[model samples]
Structures are given as structure tokens and as C-alpha cells.
Target: RRTVRAIAVACMLTSATTAVGLASLVVSKTVMLRHFGLTSGLGVMVSYVVIITFVPAVLTWVTPPKREEVRRERTSMFTKVSNGLVARLLRWRWAVLVATDLFTVGAGYVASGITVDHALLDQFDETDPVYTTTLLIEEKLAGVRPLEVVLVSTEEDHFMDPEMVQTIQKIRNWAALRPEIIRTSSYGDMLRESYVLLSGDPSVRSENFKSAKQVKGLVTMMSQRDPSPLNDWLTQDGKKARVQFKLRDVGAQATMRFLDALEQEIESELGDDETVSVSFTGEAYTASRGQAAVVNDLLGSLLVAVVVIFLLLAFFFRSVRLGLLSIPPNLIPLVATMAYMVWREIPLNVSTVIIFSISLGLAVNGTIHVLARFREEMHTGIGREAALVRAARGTGRAIVISCVTLMAGFSVLLLSSFVPVRNFGELIAITIGGCLVATLLVLPPLLSVAGGDGGVRDSSD
Candidate 1:
């Protein structure tokens, strides 16, 4: 009952912050992400209720450990580390604070360099069979990634015109020269092959035909009753034609570069022509487009989480400084996660960017627990230093135990076959470890120097 009473509010507040982070996913442009946010957010709150209510009910029947045993557990650690350790550290609190500021500056700089992109096969490592087979298929046969190029003309049989055919040839010829494109196919190639086969004259050339009439003559010679593969590339009336560009499965950087270059090429090739406009659609292209959306949506989600949490902290403690102080414990962990991404070569893609909000939501729990305990201790009229020391020593063990449990839980995901899942696990563990250190060591000196002597009494009175 004593334990539950002491920690219940902090646990509930932690759940609220975590739920806010998870629930902010509704703003995501992706449906899967939205659903995930709703369910996970709801789950966190439900778990909080269960922990506070159900655990207390069960504890009522269980006998507590004797007071002496508890005292021994607490005082034993004090003897070695010494209770004056916190006060001793505060004598040079200025140095500790300065070092923390320097670390933050470096973390911010490293975080700024993260790049974003997305890919399907990226979920698996290069050594995985799926990844290796994909590469082999692309190298041996052709690019498994298909980019569809469709040309629409308002006029009937527009693609049959020799001029349109020449335009198609220009695109194919351009693609052929690009190393990224494994192969290109279109109705123009088909018509040229048919024109030669039917003419039975090697001298007759496809590019030589200068008018729609000449191309139409070749098409007319083929029996309507016979099915031709060219029909699939062209509509019944030939208003639209399809050109397939099979491209190699280049990595994210190269793939995005190629897409940008293609966009420019299409604009330059068909400039000022009202009759034709180009757009891209395919899994590979869609993934590239979604990268921008991921960055925008996830960044917005992170903002929502931070704003909501700051407001909550400010309201709960009734001290804006405390709320503001809560930020570094969370921010340092977030920056550490970004640095982890950079160090590990993990791109800030769809699977990994959400770590910022999730880890931030988590990192605040220890800070809140410590501060909340400090408030409880201050109410007894102890000096600020005595209260902070009491709070840190009192809550420190529970925080360590909780952080260890969470770290163990996150580390389990390392065994996942998906690279993103594994990276997520690894990053979350690193972040929580940072948060543990920040909350225990860094937050103490901060509270001592900047938190003021009267605590909330200074503001409240």
C-alpha cells in the first residue's frame, strides 16, 4: 500500500505521456500507422489502470518484508557510495552542468546529418537469402522493379503516328544508355519488329517511316483475327501506350538519385507540350514518395508528443522550470537514438523515425518519479538539498530496476529477422540506458543548482 501510494501518480502520468506519443500516430498519413497508434495508446492506458488497481488489490493479501530488512537494503548502498555523494558532487555542479551542455551540443550536431529514404528489401539484411536472390535475379535476367511509363493522347490511334513512335524511341534509347535500367520494352519496339517481319524486306526500316499512314499500313497488313502482344501495350483505339522500364534494385541513395534524374529528364523531354504529361507510379517510386511523407508526418507526431508532454509536466508540478528541466533527460535520449542511427548506418526511414517520440515518452518516467518524490520530501520542511538527496536515494533503486526490466524487454527484439525491428530494439535500449544515466546522475545536480531552495513553495506562496 505504501509503495503503490508513493508511485501511482508518477506511473499514471508516465502512461499519459506514453499514450500521447502513441496516440499521436492518428495524424500519420499511413493507415497502418494510424491503427497502430490507436491500439498501442489504448493498451498503455489500460496497462496503467491494471498496474495501479490490480497490483494494489493483490498486495493487500501479501505480507510486507520487515522494516529492518528494508532499512538494511537502503542503508547498505549508502555506506559504500556515502550519503554525502550527492552534496559532494554539487560542490562542482557547475562543471557537471557545463559538460552536459557540451554533450548536448555534440549530439545535436550529429543528429542533424541523418538522411531519409525507404525500400522494401531494406527490411532484410544483405546476407539474407531474400536479399541475395533479389540481387541475383536483377543481375542475371532483368530488373525485377518495374517503372510504368504511360503516354496518353486525346486522339484515337494517336500512338500509331510515326511522330509518337519516334518520341517513344527517344525514351527507350535514353533508358538503354542508363546503367540503372536493365531493359526497356514498348509497342514501338513491337511495331518495328512486326513491320520488318511482314515486309519480308530487310531494307525496309522502322525509323524510316515518316507518317502515321506508313505505320498504319504495317498495322493493317496484320490480320485482325490474329492476336498480337502489341495489343496489350496499346489500347483498342490506341489512345494510351505503355512503356516498361525494368530497373536494377539499387540501394536507397542510388534509387532516389535515379528518380530525381528521371523527373528532370521527363520534364525536359516533353516540355511545353500540352498534349502529354508524365507522372510516376510503382512500388519503388511510391516508396520514394512515401519517404518525404514519413519525414513530415513523423516529425509532426514528434512535435505533438513533446508539446503535450511539456504542458502536462508544467501543469502537474505547477512549476514551468521543472517542466523545462524535464526536457534534457528526454532530449538527450532522443539525440542519442539519432546518433545511434547515424553510427549504425540506419537511415531515418519509415521503421526507425518513430523512435524519437517513443523513447522521449519513455525517458521522462524516471525524471518524473524523481521530481515527484522530491516534492513529497519537500513538504516535510526539509532543506532543498536534503529533499533532493532523499528523493534521489529513495527513488533511485526503483528507477534502476524498472529501467533494467524495460531494457531487457526491448533487447529481446534483437532476435527479430527484420533489420528495422532489430535496429529499433537496439536503439531503444541505448536510449533507455542514456535516460537512466541522465535521470540518476545528471538530473540531481540540475535540481540542486537550478531548482531553487524553496522548491514549489517559492512559487506557490
Candidate 2:
């Protein structure tokens, strides 16, 4: 009864901590992160309710006190293996510590190289229909991604003014020089083409418009066509005009760089001439802004989760040392996960970066259970070494069971058609397994060496 009670309490507390950590991600600016956070946080709570409510009830209904005692006395294969492993780990504690430190440093180095990528292309397989269709469109016609440049005239009818039209033509000519811009459509293009056709003179192009009245007449004539394309580019009041640039399928970072250069060029061209002002908007710009938001939220949420969890652990155990001890084991898995991403060239997108905080929350579950059991044993007058071994035999098996269940649950994501979802599943599985090894092999030895008198005290006492 005491054993079951301890496991139940520890499980509830651990689940609560993990839920809190995941719930924090709901505050993220990215829609995907917000969804992931809410779903994962709810999952933690549901799992706790199911485990704490159902498992014990089922156990009590089936197994009588005598049968439970007999079951406890009969050591399972997992218990035997865990006990042996703990014994061996204690003997080689110093060597294990050295290896752990080396692994952490190496993993941290690799993790530092992980970059954020939020490109839509990165989320799909190259052979996917969407990808192939985009490529085909870029080849045959204009690129799918539009970069809309809005030119606002200072005066009401200034859109037709010769100077404003000239400035727009100059901007288009500048854009034409860039190979990244596959196609550009503007009122300037229409007017220049019309001039060439009507005047029967190729030389009398865009700048040849004599005045605002001539430009306005040309615009009215163009608008009378069966389907006027000018309506899309020019506002009803003629105060605002749009230049749509159809870009080749450049990746996210390249697109952002291109936008930056294009903005600088626009400023240089029109900064001195106050005829019009330019602003940028489009799919590419929105994506760039979303990527930046995700990165900022990732850093902020991760910091908050770590600090909150550490303080919670300290409060739960009534010992700051035990809380501190829990950190390395949890952090090692996070660093190792990021290192794996770096090696695999998987950029930390909206989906992958959240794994760090999620994994930290998960990795600490086993540590908390093991530490709780160890403290219980110490309270019963057992020495540190004996308590660690017993804790390994008892709570260690529970950790393995929980981890296997979690891995199984996460493995479902592998079947997802989305690349990010699949990567997230694989990385999470690796993180769970890594945290288990650290908890079972690394954490016990750490406690024995650093926790001289077994630095944990049960807060309940």
C-alpha cells in the first residue's frame, strides 16, 4: 500500500510539472506551437488522470493483499537487471562522470550550430505534388510567391504624374536587373507597353509620357478593355499603386536577404525624390516575420520553463541541491537532441525547437521518481548506497515503463505525411530514450558522489 501510494503521488507530481512546462508554449506566437502546446499539455493531464484513477483501482480489484505481497517478493527480470546495473554503475562512478562531462561538452558544441528554418518548402518532400507544381509554375509563368510593393502618392492624382510614373519605371528597371525577380507587373509595365504599341515607336517608352493628363488618358483607355488588369494594380482614387514581383522559388533565408536588398534599393532610388513612398507586403514577408517570432518565443519559453521547473523541484524536494542535481540529466538529452538535429541538417523550425522544453519536462519525470524513492528509503534509516540500489530496483522500473509508453505514443507521429511532424516524432523518441539512460545510469552515480548524506529530504515530512 505504501509503495503504491508513493508511486501514485510521484506520478501525479511529475505529470503536473511536465504539463506546466508544455502549457507555457501556448503563449508562443506561432500557430503550430500554440496547437502543439495545448494538445501536449492536455495529453499530460489526461495521462495523469488515467494512470492515477484507473491503474490502482484495477490493481486493488484483482490482486488481494497476499497476492500483492507475493508479487512484490518475486523479482521481475527488469528489477533484477536494474539492480545489477545500479551496482556496477556505483563501482565505475568516477569513469561514468568523466564520460558524461565529455559527452555534454561535445553535444553542446554541436547544438550551438542548430539554426531556425521556417520555409514552407522545408516542410514538404521534394517529390510532393505541391512542390512539383510550384516548380512547374515557376518554369512556365510567374513564380507563386508574390512580393507586393505598394507605392503611395503624396498627392490625390499624383499616381498619373509624370515624375511619379518615372520613379515607378526606374524602380521596375532596377528590379529587372535582378535575376531573383522572375517577373514584375506594375502600372508602369502596362503604360510602357501601351506606349510602344500605340506610338509605333519602341524608343517612346515609359518616360515618354508628357504629363499627368496624358498618363490619365492612357489609364482610362486601358481600363476600358474587356478585362482591366490595371484595376488590380491601381487604386480607385489613383493614390496607391502596386508593383507585384513574382520571385523564383528561393528558400526562406535567401528571400529575406533579397527583400532587404530590394528595400535598400527602393530607398536609394526614391529617398531624395519625394513623389512617392514605398512599403512591402506579401507571403514572403509574412513568413519571414513568423520565423523571427518563433525564434524569439523559443528562447523566452525555454528559459521560463527551466527556471519554473527548477524552482518547483526545489520546493517539492525541500532541498535545492536535489533540484540542481536533476538539471544535468535533463539538459543532456536536450543538447543531444539538438546535436542530432545539427548532424542531420534539420533546422530547428516551429515544431522542433519546442522539443527542448518538452524533453526537459519529460526527462525530469524519471529523476523525480527515482529521487523521491531514494529519499523515502533514506527516511527509513537506509544508507545512501543501499537506498540508491533499492530506488533503482523500485522506481527505475516505473520510469522505464513510463518512458516506453511515451515512446510508443510519440511514435505515432512517424506515420504523418508532414516532414516536420515526422522529424519531431523521431527526435522526441531519441530524447526519451536518452533521458532514460541518463536517469538510470548517470543520475544515481551523481547522487552518490555529490549528495554526501543523500541531499534529498521528503517535503511532506
**CA RMSD for every model?**
2.4, 3.0
Top candidate, metric lDDT: 2
Look at candidate 2 and tell me the lDDT of residue 7: 74
- Model 1 lDDT per residue over 5-72, tens place: 77787888999888988888888988998999889999999999988888888888989889998889
TM-score of candidate 2 on Cα atoms, chains taken together: 0.89
Q: Please report the candidate that would top TM-score against the real structure.
A: 1
Worst 10 residues of 2 by lDDT: 452-461
lDDT of 1: 0.80
- For residue 62, model 2's alpha carbon misses the true position, in angstroms, by 1.6
lDDT tens digits, residues 54-108, model 2? Answer: 7777877784668776686557777788888999999899999999999999999
Give per-residue lDDT, candidate 2, residue 258: 88
